[model samples]
Target: MPNIVEPKLISGNANLPLAKAVARRMSMHRGMSVGLVDARVERFNDAEIFVEVYENVRGEDMFIIQPTSRPANDNLMELLIIADALRRSSAARITAVIPYFGYARQDRRTKARTPISAKLVANLIHEAGIERVLTMDLHAAQIQGFFDIPVDNLYAAPIYALDILHHFKDVSDVMVVSPDVGGVTRARELATRINAPLAIVDKRRERAGEVAEMTVIGDVTGKRCIIVDDICDTAGTLCKAAEVLMSKGATEVHAYTTHGVLSGPAVERVSNSVLKSLVITDSIEPTAEIKACPNIRIVPTAPMFAQAILNIWNGTSVSSLFERETLGPIYEGMYSAA
Candidate 1:
C-alpha cells in the first residue's frame, strides 16, 4: 500500500460542489466518508449560533474544505467550529483549505478605530487548531502574516493565462488591464505571461463599493481588454471600470478574477454591464443569479489546485508555481519609439 493512502478531507455545507471537485482530484473516488456530520450551525431564538460535529475523527489528517466568502460571519464561524471539533476529536493534522479567505481586504486598517479583521480571523483559526492553510488570491497578500502556521497561497494566474491563450488567438489586439491602481502588480504578472500589453485603470474612491472615475493610464481603444483582479465582490468597481474603458472606445471587455465573492446584486450588475464576459475561478461558488446569466463563464482551477495539493502532500516546494512571471520577460519591443 502507498505510504500516503489517503488524507481524509472533510467538507461542510459552505460550497459542496467545489469541495467535491477538489476531492475528486485528490481521491480516486469522490464520496464522503460515513459518520462525518454536517457540523450543522444554526441560529437560536435569540440569534446566536450552535455548532455540532457528529463524527469521531481520531488521528486523521483532516482537511476542511470551506471558503469563507459571503455571510462572512456565519461561514467564518462554521470554519472555526469545525476546526475546534476536529481538534477535540484528536485529528493528527487539520488543514483549512479555504479557497476564498474573507475579511482579507481588511489587512490594513484604514481608520484609527478600524480593526484589521483579517488578523482577527487568522487568530481565530489558530486558536481553533488549524495546523495549516491553503487558499488562493487573498485580497491582501500580507494577511498570511496574521498566522504563524504554514500557508500555501496558491496561484490561479497560470490557469487564467492558459485559458486566455486557448480562447483568444490574436495577440496584437489583446490587452490586460488592472481595474484599479492597487491591482497593477497582479495584472502585470498575468499580462506578462500572455505577451500582451498592460493597461491600468486610474480611479478614486468616493466611498466604499463606489469608485470615482478618473482616467485610463494606458491606451485601450479598439483592443480586446481583459481586467485581472483578485476579488470581485459587489462588481461595482468592475462594472464601472468596464464602462469607463468602453466609453474610452475599447473594442471589448472581459475579466478574469480569482475569487468571485459576488455579494448582493453583483450578478445582475455584471450581466447588465458593458463587459462581454466575466470569468472567475471556483474559489467561491457562484450565486443563483450568476448561473442564470450567459455572460459569466467559470473556468476550473481544479488542475492547478490539485497539483498544489499533491505537492504539499509530498512536501515539495510550491514556489515554482510562480515561474510564469519569473521564467521569461514578456515585454520585448515598442520600447525606443520615444
Candidate 2:
C-alpha cells in the first residue's frame, strides 16, 4: 500500500535484450528508478537451474521478466525458481512478466487422455508465489481463468496497426484476411483499426501442424492483403494462405503476427512464400535465420510494455493503452527501439 521507492526488474536467460530495452524505456519516466537486479540465473554442471539474488528486495516491488519461449522447460524453470527466490527474500509483490507463455496452445483437452498443459503451467506459477502475470497475446483468452491471480494479457494489435499504416499509406485497397476461422476475431480487430475490409480463409487440418485444405471465403482480387494471427510456428499455414490469396487474384500479401515462433523451417518458408513481408513483434527473441530473412520484419514492444508496467505499478487503467488516439504517440516514429 505504500509508494514504491524503486522498481526492481530481474530477467532470466530467455530474452535479456528485451528486458534491458524495457528497463531503458522505464528510465524515461520521472521518479521511477528502474534497474536490473544483481542476480544470477545460471546452470549447473548437470543442467540444473540455479538462481541467486544478491540485492535486498525485502518489501520492494519486484518483476521477473522472463518469456517462456524456446527451450521452454529450462526458461520456465528459471521463472519459477526466480519467483521462489524473490518470495523467500520477502519482496512486497512479485509479478511474472512472461511475453510468451509456453504450453499456452494446450489450453484444453483435444482428445481423450490428453492433458491440459496450459492450466497445469498456470497452477505451477500460482504455487510458485507469484501474485500476478503479465503476458502478451495469449493463444486462448480463457487461459487467464486458469490462474487465481490477476493476469494482464496485452495485445500487439495496436503496434501491428501502426506499422501497417506506416507501410501502406492508402488503406482503400487493403484487405485483412484471417488464415483460418479461429483467427477471424483477431484479424477483424486489426481490420477495424486500419479501416480495411475483412476476409476469411477456410482451412481443414486433418492432423496437427499441417493444413490439408484451404479455401478463400472472400474476394481478395487485386487488393493488397494482410493475414493476421497470434503465432507463426513453422509458418506452413501462412505460406499456404499467401499462395491461396495470390491465386485468388490478390495483388500482394503480407502478414502480421504477435509471436514469431519461427521454429524449424518457418523462416525458409516465409522467405520463399508469396507473402511480400511478414511483420512480428519482439515477444520472442528472433533466431539467426529469422534475422537473415529479408521478408521478415520486427517491431519493438518495449515502449508498450514499459507503459503497461508503469500503469500497473501506479494502479491505473491498463486497457486504455489500446485506445486509437493514444497509440499514435506511444508508437510514433518507432520503427525500432533499444
Best by TM-score: 2
Per-prediction TM-score to the true structure, in the order listed:
0.88, 0.97
Model 2: per-residue Cα lDDT over 35-148, one tens digit each: 789999999999999999999889888999999999999999999999999999899999999999999999999899999999999999999999999999999999999999
Question: Against the true structure, candidate 2 has what lDDT?
Answer: 0.90
Listed per candidate, the RMSD to the true structure in angstroms reads 6.2, 2.1
Clashing pairs in 1: none
Off by over 4 Å in 2: 1-3, 31-33, 335-338
* Model 1 residue 54 CA deviation in Å: 5.2
Candidate 1 stretches with Cα past 4 Å from truth are 1-5, 29-56, 323-338
Candidate of highest lDDT: 2
